[model samples]
Structure formats: structure tokens, C-alpha cells
Target: MAAPHDVPSAAQLVAAVRDFLADDVLPAVEGRVRFHTRVAINVLGMVEREIELGPAQAAEHERRLAGLGVADDAELAAAVREGRFDDSALVEALRDAVGAKLEVANPGYLGDG
Candidate 1:
């Protein structure tokens, strides 16, 4: 379904551009231009996924941070820098942050975690 605005919501717009680059532009280009077009398409694909997943990921991130008793990443990092986190908390925080990033940057890179 279209958004309440009636047409081409942000994710839809991103997908349209990504499809255009991959389907139309990729087939017609060659060498360096093709490589760059492929990169652009991948970037747009990431944008579309981010549009869809970023909100939920952000909420989860905040929740995880709260569980660690911090407000945001800076606090968590500062604690880590000061050797505040125990081994388990340090590992968990790092894993959650990296996992959230992979969910946007490259889900394929993630393991069963």
C-alpha cells in the first residue's frame, strides 16, 4: 500500500532508483562506469533497507543502551574507554552495536547471532 501521502514513499523512491540503475543502467554500461553504477545501485539498496529497518534498529539500540545504564553510544564508549564494562557487558555491547550496523551495511556478513 502507498503511504498516506499517496505515492512514492521514501523506500519506494529508493527502490525505484536502485532498480533503474541495476536493470537499465547496468546492462548498458561497461568497465568503470558499470562498476560505479553497480556501486550506486548497492548504495540505493542500502538506503531502501535503512528506510525500512532503521527505526526498529534505533529503538533496539536505545533499549540495549538502557540495559547497560547509558543513554547513547558516546556514554557506552566512554565507559568502555575507562574500563568500566566487565567482560560480558563489553562483549554484549560490542556485539549488539556491530550487529545493528551489519543489519544495515551487510546482513549477509552476520552469523547465527
Candidate 2:
């Protein structure tokens, strides 16, 4: 059977390929081949997560930047340097942003999880 018309999206495709490598390829290989296959699987996993989480993360990031009165990271940094925003607010915003990134990059490192 094929994927439904709306099924197997970009994230799904990446996840399917990642699963293929992990389940079918990883165990079938050894040594350097195994190592590289593992890396490919890890990278594909990250890609899948990014596909699923990137849009929401981006929107949240943009909102954070807007709240800080900046267009982008560079502007945010400039604002920080100029002390244009509340220090506590800026720190909270940055920490929240980092946590959101860790959510996609690796939730385990986010501490609160």
C-alpha cells in the first residue's frame, strides 16, 4: 500500500528513511560502516525533528525578537549591547529561546524536559 494522499509528509519521509537506516542498515553493518550508518541515522533524525518543529520554533523566535524590538539575531544582539531592553526580560527571552532550540536539537539537554 502507498501512503495516503496527505500522509507521509516531509517529516514522515525523513523519519521513514531514518528508521530504515536504524532498523535495517545499522544492525547489518559493522565497524566504520556501522559508525557512518549511525551518523546518517542521527542526522536524519535531527532533520525529521526540525521539519516537525522548525515552523513553530521560528514563529516563536520571531515573536521573541519582536518583543525585544529587533528584526533578527543581529539586531537583538545590538539591542542587548545598547541596553535597550530590560536585562531580566532579555535573559528570560534568551533562555526560553535556547530551551526551544534544545527541544528540537535534543530535549534531554533542556533540563526541565
Candidate 3:
């Protein structure tokens, strides 16, 4: 008995479809609509993912900064508005804030790190 090869693999079909969409369909489309649509869809997907995870991430960051005994939210907010954290302690505070955010919000989301 021999294995049949009538069907294409999913990866092969997807690649073929993408190539067709890009080289044939997209080029035939008028104006910047297609280009903008593609960008908008991509950005919307990213925003959706961020919205789902941003809050927990922010909370974790706040907790870490609080642990570091850094300045309160009002102070951080003011510094951010002024476009600088300035001091080394402040920088470390920001680092810890971000690290904790990533750690909790996406722990294991980074893959083996």
C-alpha cells in the first residue's frame, strides 16, 4: 500500500494563499485601501491582545514599584509627563516596574527565558 498525496499540507496551502493574495489579488486592488486595511487589521489585533492583558500587567508593575519604595503614582506620572525618570533610583524603579509587569502578565509568554 502506498500513501496518497492528493491533499496539500496546511502550511503549503497557507503559503500558496498568501502568495496569491499578495502577488495577484492585492496588486489588482485600487488605491491605498488594501494597504491600509491590512495595517488596520494588524494593529487592531495587537490592540485587542493588549487590552486583554494590559490591566494585569499594570497592576503587577504598580506592586513591584511599591515594593521598591519608589515614589507614588502621582510622582511617577509627573516624571513621565516631564519625559524623564532622572535619577538612578528612579530608573531602577521603572525597570522593576516593567520587569514585574512582564513577569506576571506574560510569564511563560516569552518561551523558555
Candidate 4:
């Protein structure tokens, strides 16, 4: 998608700030400032991941929900609680959906880093 405004689109601007916080601000800060900087950096990282993966994740989530005979996560959860489907495939699909979420939220948890 072409940016009609100018150079440095929103994602670019976010990336720049995130990088600055990680590379410069983080190094100089201490105690609460450092902790908050880390949190801010993580939030920025999640934002970047969502910007990159949110659409694909949404489509995959919908597809997985349909495969499990549910329209959304709530329905899926209800079905799971009710034991409507007892199959490894359902479990695997749910696992994959969660894995996708973790990938966006914290990829390091899966040792992706």
C-alpha cells in the first residue's frame, strides 16, 4: 500500500521509535525507567507483529473456527467445554491458533528468537 501523505509511514514511524527505545533509551535508563522501557519495547514489538500478522491470523482463526464447527472463539470455547468434539485434530487446531497468538504476543516463548 502506497502512503499518500509522505515518507515514513505509520509503521515506519513506529519502528523508528521502537528501535530508538531499544537501542538508545533502554541503555541509558535504570530501575523503573528501564523496566518501563522494556515494557514499551515489548508493546512496540507486539504492535509490529500485529501489523504484520494480524490479517493472516484473523483469516486462520476464522478458518480454524469453521473447521471446528464454530463461528468464533466463544463458540469454540463453549464447544470445548461441552466436549462436543473429541479429536486430536481439534486439539491441534486449537494449539496452532494459540501458537499463532503467542507468535504475535511473544515469539521468544516458543524459542523463535
lDDT of each: 0.86, 0.87, 0.59, 0.87
lDDT of 4 by residue, 27-109 (tens): 99999999999999999989988877888899988998888889988888798889899689788897898899998999988
Best by TM-score: 1
Task: Indicate the residue-level lDDT of 68 in model 4.
Answer: 82
Give TM per candidate: 0.89, 0.86, 0.41, 0.88
> Which parts of model 4 have CA positions greater than 4 angstroms off?
2-7
Clash-forming residue pairs, model 4 = none
- Name the better of 1 and 4 by TM-score: 1
Off by over 4 Å in 2: 1-5
lDDT of 1 at 43: 91
Error of 1 at 82 (Å): 1.0
Segments of candidate 1 deviating more than 4 angstroms: 1-4, 111-113
For residue 16, model 3's alpha carbon misses the true position, in angstroms, by: 22
Which residue pairs in candidate 1 have backbone atoms (N, alpha carbon, C) closer than 3 angstroms, thus clashing?
none
Q: Write the per-residue lDDT of candidate 1 for residues 31-103, one digit (tens) a residue.
A: 9999999899889888888889898888988888998888998898898789877789779877888887888
Number of clashes recorded per candidate: 0, 0, 0, 0
